[model samples]
Target: MGRRRRRKPKWVPERAIVGELDRRGRAVVAAGEDGRPREAHVDGALPGESIEYLRCDREGPVDAARTLEVLEPAPDRVAARCPHYGVCGGCSLMHMDPDAQVAFKQATLLADFASHGVEPERVLPALRGPTWRYRRRARLGAKLVPGKGKVVVGFREKDRRFIADLSTCEILAGPAQGPLADDPGRLISALSELIGSLSIAARTPQIEVSAGDRELALVLRVLDPPSAEDLDRLRAFAAQYELRIFLQPKGLDTVAPLETGRELLHYGLPDFEVELGFRPTDFVQINAPLNRAMIARVVELLELEADHRVLDLFCGLGNFSLALARRAAQVVGVEGDAALVERAQANAAANAMTNLSFEQRDLYKEPGAFEWPGGPFDRVLLDPPRSGAAGIVEHFEAIAAPRVVYVACSPETLARDAATLCSRHGYRLAAAGVMDMFPHTAHVESIALFER
Candidate 1:
């Protein structure tokens, strides 16, 4: 018996809806004659701007939408520098002026604090640096579309799974500095056939970019081994652009340089007289200048003394541990990744720092499972991931650190942790402010000082 013919789903009509911007910089409107208030999060929107958006779909209690037109643009609204601004998902908030972007970030932090019924006693001046060409690391998507007859390399499209076709990236390939920076499209196009061949077999899907002060490394995630001819082509391309190419067949541990005797990538903190060597895939700050500034700020806020001992948690590769050790009598760093711990230890030794030490432990698990030095710690520094440091915060009293400084990338998680440290542990939020670690985007990197 023949099955009944299936009908295609009707397309949802696009409606022009207007709304005011909410704290998140999204155009928001309550339930009204226009549409459901919860349904509108208009992209490319700024506060105080009346924008027209096409309702797309419902996302939980909120409505997802796309900005159609700005009937009355906000005063701070400016032209986005990147040609791929609206279409590329890599950056948002670029429409707003750079200064306004920082202000919005500060406001977001304050609003998050308010939601938790807490506020910082003082807010520090926002820290900022070069907004463009500041990104030192990026994971670019690589795909081959036969229909397009080329390889596409860049970020994914906004709110979509498909990659956005990009010739160059302003963020990573700073201001046409070199062949790698000026025309990344040429690099991808040159290697398109090889990449496309592997991609068709579901072998290589992504390329990670990590640039140091002098060197740039591209780690290609390959699902299968490449032929000798492919290696020759890759080597030639690498030599042409002065790029260090590493291929990963399965895991991060499997990543190895195409040729032996490759140079190691490193960045220097001249102020602290410290240089840190790292693998391309390691977790280093994408913005180099901001990182130097951030380390300085953290050290200043901690008020480190030669006699004071510091504890650095989530200390990836001893970026903070080595820096703190330079000032403090002793700095102990703990991280979950054993490889990072080894790297941190090696970094300390390379800098000839005998006072700093690092340990490997799953901080989220039972603290007692791993032995930690009994601490009458004078101060503590935390640079946790987005999940926040709930595990560490829960055991603050046990550590008995008089002062605590938290560096966070997520305001929501920071707010949650702040509440716990204050209400549950009798710590006061002394000073907090946003850092422009990621500009042209909604990401908020913040630091908060807490005292018991």
Candidate 2:
């Protein structure tokens, strides 16, 4: 008996072109289907590019079309450097020019600021670094596809949760297995080959990749334990590449080195004469050069005086706090993660930073819950996550630091928190700008200084 064939999706306007880019950098396509103007977003498409995509029968909150073909590209559109551009969800702005990408991110940040009824007194130039191979940390997805008889390792698809078949990645830092140069081609392929040879390839769900100045570590998340042969292969693979290999059976605390003599993942800020140690699961800035530049900018903006006391909130592993300690008289770094707080303390001690102190406090909770800190600080630095520093913004009087610098990963949340600070805390948005922490993606990392 013959089986029913799959039906094609009901895509509209067989001939359509993207008119412009939206605030989020998405390509916006306006089409008049059945004489009614309809709008939909085309993925992997640049503005002024003609494209073809699948449109389902019913539209979603934001109608997203996939499998796009750029018939006539935009003037500013450039060929994607990554071979797995469209399939891999790691990057969405590779087709757009790098300078344009930075501008788009800046515009996104500024628009958010304007929407929240706040504006920066001065707009700083976008902070940028190398356009390629800047990502030093990533959690790659792993899956064993049926019939393929091998493991597929890469980022998930742009529209789906399935892993993209990736042989190499351009944005990711190359794992230096031995003495050879950092080659992107060998990194993903070697990881794929290693996992495919394992008995528990299907049971492995993730590979947490992180690279420090001299160390590149991979932590394999295993659902089930591997056999004796699997351990031999893993150990050999680790030794061959001279890569730090770790295994995680369940929780993050369970992650351990596969072999002995594993050193703590380390990086250094030469400008500040500071070195930091971190675990593979710890949150560090993806772009090292850009991070150093950012810390410099933050220090310059704060105009840290030798007699001033500074507060660094959400200071993970003392990345900024360490740098600030080099300039400020006293620096107090607070983070919610106890583990990171401990790491920060160790880093401060290792650097012989007597002026810096590390503390653990959930900055997201009520500010009155804790005995806060010795504040009325001269300067305050907030490096919050995507949720922003909403909880503490209300009780700004507790710290009431005259000068506050906020480093944010989310522009919308930054704008929201800026509104709270300006309206209630008597702070003015002094200066603001973005940093290309993750290029070729919509992720915007911005820094703002507030003055009272």
Candidate 3:
């Protein structure tokens, strides 16, 4: 007899059933197409290999098991370098392609508007900067382990309470890079020779590296006062790096120099020839390039003219006021912090700007008697903190500037405030778009132009 040919096994179409059986007695569990009980399958069976997913529909929640396919990665899928990408909460979308991530953010804004019965005619393409290693500010948690006899500083892990063992964070800017990245554990161990104990703090824990046009400043937020030996090591590190070191002990009030002979720590805005000096604990935007871009965008939105007067709300150290003074007839900056107001005034003087003024006001609180700079003000620029300008929206409405440009860091607050301004104040959202200020993180920085 001729040799019998064997038939080739057919390829399964993802939902194919492996087998079926009948039970004469006893309870029989619903079987999946892979011949395994639906609950017993792992990875939910290979892709294309049967796995029925039963849905409650038509028959009203039947017990019969149905085969379903496994979920696959999205089309824009790309590999991320961080070991803690999915598990670590720090960078939520690092796995996504950077370009796609920007597009997704833009799409989200469009979706938000479409739902609100408004469509923007133009959206400036996302103002993108270096996507990776661009963070100039970070607050790191400092934990001391007795076994290790040192401090561990970095961002915490997503799933676990403990910090991730990261040596170099790709998300931090180059100036913010630490020796720890080469060998984090070993580096912390070495630092023990100088420091005593550590505890939780802000985003970038040990050395807060604020960027500038010329020099860099490293502000160290020490939970406890540094020991003599520690100070010496730090001084040596400063000398080695040729960096200015500021010690922050308790709070913003406690930030000062260790041994002063050198110049004060300040970052420069060369475009406006303005220098801003801030303590490490003070709030400053993390991304420098984008910050410059944002400030420029705010100025451009103001549509400044030689004779126009402008108001800058929550003006921190005259960032916008000075920029406005360059073009407008006069600029008034109002801030809640008296110290910041003083600093703003000093900054104006430092830059030799005459048309800028600063005032201290608790804009968030209902003041019994308050003063507003006399104005038929041509335009108003507001950059309030995350809480939004809820307390002063009426005053803003009262002023009734023909144009208002708002720079916001929170979308929900911005949306609420924008809605109020539009419905109550009669200003329309003329243009708005997200800025990639804090990339790889969920933080959204946006700007909007409102016109009557």
Candidate 4:
């Protein structure tokens, strides 16, 4: 008997689809012969704007597609500033007007709240700042593509595993006065060959970029020890660009500065009169102006007094804790990471803030699993991650704080926690609004106030 022949996978051809944008800015439509609904999140398409799209692939019921042509452009649609807008995945909503972008974010937040059967009594004005050149921190991908004969350094390609060849990054804050400002790509191209010489270049994934008001630092994540020549080249590159270079052979603990007796990187909170020193790997907000704005807003909402005691949960580097300390009689910060807790304490001490104290504890643990100190305070502040503070909210009654301010990065999780607080804990949603921490991206950072 002849051997059975193997069947080849069928080729799926791209087809035109018309769709309208939903709340999340994705185009929702029914395409193909079956007429099933599919969500195509094309970057440039906006709500009420009809567009032609080419279906790329399907994930369950949704068909991922790219905008082939905008048959009818939205009134808010504008030209994107970045030359690499479509190819680079860094900024998704650049084509939309700035005002429209914020409106979309507000609408999306409201939709998220509605989904969870919660709504704020008042929607605060959206907090916004500089739209371009606002990013002070970024993790850039680096790869030495031998076939291309050069290194590609930038963000990843749109929906692809490969890195985008970026000639310039409009959103990234460039050097004040140097060639780097004119051609930021030179930073990677100059070091491409040197990085290729290293044995771990294949495994080295990324170079972390951290920029302060005064200095820019690059942390190279290396998988293996560098040769003597490699070190020399790195030092030379640092000296030439006036940048502080750090080498990381393993984890965050392994990151070290190449030059001896170098000053640490810091950003100033001029309004609060606080200066925060942090390592390259430390977690700091990417946008400086917006962070300062957010902090001021938090202080205003807390209505802190000299006799009031406050609690700050998930406090990192004392960004909000130190500021709260200035207004409140005393502030206690709690964090899960020991390193961040230590840093927060050091920052408080450096600022001569005797009213502030920090402790390291797993905040997500069960209510009685871990002991919380210096709580049952007058006011409480929680700046949780994207996962939200479910663990803390589960035990909110134990703290019994009258007013609670939640700074959240995810609306879905925030809505979930809001539902828990309002429905279960008898707290009312006073006000909520979105902060434009990352412009041109779908990321939403927001703050909400709750009171009983």
Candidate 5:
């Protein structure tokens, strides 16, 4: 017995392996029957081209064996036009099929309040407009590269520092007037030639291209002071492009027109014959068509009347205030920024809207004490930022506006404030709905009508 004969393990043939070689765990990443990751599995499958299936890592109470449930069609839903749609992380629901987007947003509003045991009389239809290239304002990021002999400008990659090497953005309505989405590098090169560094900012990640009813005012964010040659280059480019340029040397306080003539960026509410004069960096809605729809929705919700006195809080450039003034007897717009108030006043005057007046008062700090032109409004419209009007929720009760229209960009904040309105302020959640302002994005823009 030669050291108690040891037994060797037999080798299993590769052919005996189970499943395809590319199959990894629960997901089979092999090319689909056609190609591309399978139409994002409407069920548990992940829509990706990798051979590995990642484990569910989402926190909270997600069922381990949960599967996705597809809903019915919505009229507003459509196939997202941008190729950079999913990866850019800017838009979320692009693939959801149009009308579905509206349904989802509507459902989001309903779900927000169902937990709070509140319901509105109606969940209105989602407000919609052109689905692609509708953004009128965009703030594209810029970076200079030494070896590339130029710079790069566009939105940052989804949740990352790097920029998406995109050529065209169909969502930007004014893309045609500027460099095509695929060619942002051209804009970067132009700016690099004109200045040491350059950046662009607009309400949307896309810049407004057309000098439509409004002039094309571009805010060129600078990292350092431009040299004289740089200024001349920029001036010439602006002249050739027929665009107005503003320089941001420091914080927003330092923003000013590089070349000031009588030219103005004046967007219009064509339906109302209202011409709104806005400088670059003003908080105008990026989608002109959607803005018109939102205004119409607000007016419809407010049931504005000649005798109605409305208070628009956080009113930027009097978008809602002027619209309210057209119908209401008096409209008081309050804002935290003095510069915006001045612009709002100018816009009101330019439109010749007699009943609206704007005031500069911080709602979060000096919410109630500041003297406003009109008081005791019959209705109040609140368009606070993502933080919601937490500091002023209580003031709503004291003011006793018969109706309140809260336009919110965040649903969690809307729900929180809605709770306050119903629970603490003795107001009823009358109606709530979502607007497709930023479609394909997780950002939810909501409008909730409250009655006291």
Candidate 6:
């Protein structure tokens, strides 16, 4: 028996009168014909542009296609900075100007609110930060291609799972920015080359990257153990580049340093006179400067007083809790991960703050299994993951806090929760706005305030 040949889907080239940008930042068009209009999302286009695209994918209600050419360009479109702009899935909206990018995201957030009949009284000015070289955390895919006889390392190609063959990246927060430091050597090329030359390149599937205030680290996800010679090569590479290397043979918890006695990864919050630490594999914001700005804005919306007690939900390693403790009288930080809870406890002790505490419990579990924290809390803050705090938000009445602030990564979830808070609960949606946390991508990070 022989393997059957795979048949390629036949694509029909069609020109679309593209309309507004959808939630994912792709241009939408009316594709249906039976007295109904179904949105056909076309990439590589802006609003009002006529684009030639090949329609080949059907994603539920919407058809997906990649743009072949823009028959007419939109006024807001701009030249992309990186050469790998369209191919690299790491960024979308690079063709649109920064202002336009933020505006599109803002519209997306507001429109989501409008759909739910929950409008913010005021749209806070979108929180903007440095657009390029701002990503402090990333995971680059590594794959060994036998035909090319090389390991391709970078972000996955758009609409595909394979890694893009990248020589340089404009958005990676690599080292060497001072007057005399070399530019070309500090970015993606050197890292890609180093990984390519390794003996265990095939077994290494991905590399996790993290940057603190003063240090950067890399953790390689290796499926198999490396040989003694492979260790030597990795060590030489690390020493030459002033890099910290770790290897994970299995789970994230299994990550171990290639070199011992190294510094623990950490970042500082100078605004609150606090410094926090974490493992390289831990979750942190992709943008550092924006995270700081966001925290300030959050504190403002929270309106914390010296006598007020704050409840921080989904608090990972006290990122916001420690800062909140600086202003509020008492703070309780709750997390699902026991390790992160321990880290949060250690951070509170190190900061010499006795006003904050962290407790570990799975927040998504069925109700009544876990006791909701009974509170005379004056303020509440929720920063749940994309599966926005449904099980938790419905229970906020138990806390009966006068104010609530939500930091969200998904606008859809945020809007849904906003409606819940307003309709079922007595809170009002006061204000909401987007943040450029992952600039150039359609990933929306936003904040909202609710008052009773």
lDDT by residue for model 5 (1-452), tens? 46976443332211110111111111122224333322111112223312222222222321111122213322333555676764554455565566655665676667777766777888877788877666667666655555565554556675466766554565655433443333322443354344333332121122323334435656766655666766777688778655677777667777778876743577777666687877667677877888898998899889887899988999988888887888889988989988789999998888777888778887899555654455777999999998999878865655778888999987778888888889877888888888888765545688999987
Please, what are the lDDT tens digits per residue for candidate 4 over residues 1-452?
Answer: 99997653332433334455554456665554344344455556776666666666666666666777887787888998888898888888898899988987887888899999999999999999989888878888888788987667788888778798876688886455555665554565555665666666776678888877677789998877777887888888787887888988887888889987663688889888999988878999989889999999999998888899999999988999998988999998999899899889889888888998888888877754655677669999999999999978877887778899999999889999999999989999999999999899878889999999
Give Cα-based local distance difference scores for all models: 0.81, 0.85, 0.62, 0.81, 0.64, 0.85
Candidate 5: global Cα-lDDT?
A: 0.64
Per-residue accuracy of model 2 over 181-257 as CA lDDT, tens digit each = 46754677788889999999999989988888888889999999999999999988877777789999999889899
- For each predicted model, how many residue pairs clash, with residues at least 3 apart or on different chains? 3, 1, 19, 0, 22, 0
lDDT of 6 at 297: 94
The candidate with the higher TM-score, 4 or 6, is: 6
Provide the clash count, candidate 4.
0
Error of model 2, residue 325, in angstroms: 0.6
lDDT of 1 by residue, 194-272 (tens): 4765423246788888888777888898877887777877887788787888998888889899878773688888888
Per-candidate RMSD, Å: 3.3, 3.5, 13.0, 3.2, 10.0, 2.9
List TM-score per model, in order. Answer: 0.91, 0.93, 0.75, 0.91, 0.76, 0.94
Give the TM-score comparing model 3 with the true structure, all chains together.
0.75
Off by over 4 Å in 1: 1-25, 33-38, 173-202, 368-371
Model 1 TM-score?
Answer: 0.91
Off by over 4 Å in 6: 1-9, 32-39, 175-186, 367-374
